[model samples]
Target: MSLFWKESDERGHPSLGTVMRGVVLLAFLLGGWLPSSWANQVWEFVDGEGVTHIGNVPPSAATRGVIWLSRVPPASVVKGKDRGPSALQFPGYDDVKQHLEAAAVAQSLDPAFVIAVAAAESAFNVKAVSRKGALGLMQVMPATAERYGVAARPSSDGEHAAMEPKVNAQIGTRYLADLLRMFDGDKELALAAYNAGEGAVIKYGRRIPPYPETQQYVEKVMRFYRGLLR
Candidate 1:
């Protein structure tokens, strides 16, 4: 399962500065960054030992110790609610980019594609738990993990195993690759299968299922995937 790995000191990895820049750029795209038209308010606040969370929708009411980072134009609320952990939870791309790249490459997937999926699924929250019992960075269900041979161990239970960032990335990307193959390399169909189910995709004659969430998920991830590659 440990494939597509590079040395920790691998040359040519993007620098921290580059990662930060990329994070901001990706955040802008995801959060609907407007140019010369308006500014979105991403509130920043510190908690327990100075961990700061910058969020378009602040965790709570803004008060002292809450800060906002503005870039040109007047501050305004950004449209759309974000998934758990939000975009700002990722302080920089460096935090998760390498894992995304490694897992994607391991599964013969485009790194940006994997990243886009992760962005949509959990927003890089390694501990994210969905209401439907999906868990971890990739929001992997324990059953899915079992099917993929990365099922959680009995000692740690399936939940904790899926919570591991690297494990989740690997298993999740592998599952995505499986979906792609099942759909004959059609990314849209593959994504639909990933979000909805292989059964749903097939029931719909290999077209993206008509479910609103699945359709929106496919489009959003594709947008990020294409934008990042460009």
Candidate 2:
């Protein structure tokens, strides 16, 4: 699940500074650090410290902190989109399809599934970065990538080398495979771990955690996966 967990206080609460830093960093990334092309009218939501979301439709009621890039409002945006949720597109998916396939094959995983996860995670944005510091097409954290044998070298852009498309796919697919094995080949639990951290899944008795972000993530990925399969 988590590439590396943030330190918590004696009472098992994340430090206030850590939480604040994440919020500020998210604002910076969304507001400016990312490419202007990513500024599409998107609806987003943040549930706790999990990876942020950008989808065509509004998030579920269980979610909090809905973020809108436009004054149009989430409901209005969704209603205006004639193509519906399926209208969500992966902008650069074609560019990294080969890498995704290679990594999936190397890990004995379904390439469609791997691609779906990447699509859901980053929309195939090679330069994607999350508030929790997850990066690249697969959004693998640097520490977690290192744990999977991907060395953490800084790129010229200040992003970690693990963010490199090929390397990120490799580490991410490997991690997914491990999570699949850990959960006895259950893709749902594996995905829940991918979104919410493996420890969170175990803590919740190997079921998908109740976090709305994680629940929606699993559903979205599987939906993408099924679409890919067809």
Candidate 3:
């Protein structure tokens, strides 16, 4: 993920003198920015080459070097816990249970299987977005959205139809149900199609593709589902 910070003036063009003044002001501001609330919670580490870095936790690069600094207080703690599900706690567990039960009742599929699919797809992250621009909890892609009557609008305020958790889940579950039907209730084939695509799976003669990522993704999701059962 990329994060951006604005540190410059908004003017498109500034005189050289103004730019110099701005740089000086920025330097002063940065100098005074130390000993902040987060200082105590922040830590610093040195690499093998003696280059130092400051962060909330030891930098991953420190593995190549001896410990220059152990766990130190952060300058400040972000006062909140992670709002997402863990390996143990699935978000919206009750709602997922209800939805799975309803799906199983209506489609004659297994509720545990549906839950497993949800676990694999988004880990219940309602705002999950895949690299291919799939959206919402179940990661419904644009073409699939169109096939399932999900409206694709420009991503903006009031264009949140696609982001609604229930809408996304409903459409995703329905699409999965269709895939299940297409594969004649073969869960493996259906899952493979979900991860890769139905066309790819069909072209490969109903087998998991030779692509390593797709194959591993299918297997991992199945493993997670199986774990849920146990």
TM-scores for candidates 1 onward, in order? 0.62, 0.65, 0.58
lDDT of 3 by residue, 20-116 (tens): 2211222322211333554434433333443334354323432443343322232111344222112224445565566555755566677667766
How many steric clashes between backbone atoms does each model show? 0, 2, 13
- Point out where model 1 deviates above 4 Å: 1-92, 154-159
Tell me the tens digit of each residue's lDDT in model 1 across 92-193: 356777888899998888887898788656556666665456766777777887787776666534455767888889888998998999988999998888
Q: In candidate 3, how many Å is residue 91 off? A: 4.1
True-structure Cα RMSD, model 1: 12.9
lDDT to native, each model: 0.58, 0.64, 0.53
What ranges in model 3 sit over 4 Å off? 1-88, 91-96, 153-160
Q: Which 10 consecutive residues of model 1 have the lowest summed lDDT?
A: 2-11
**Cα deviation of 56 in candidate 1 (Å)?**
13
TM-score between candidate 2 and the true structure: 0.65
Query: Which tens-of-lDDT digit does each residue in 44-163 have in candidate 2?
Result: 434365433444333445444433222111222234432213313445667898999999999999998898888767667677665557777787877788898777666676778887
Model 3, CA-based lDDT? 0.53
Number of the predicted model whose lDDT against the real structure is largest: 2
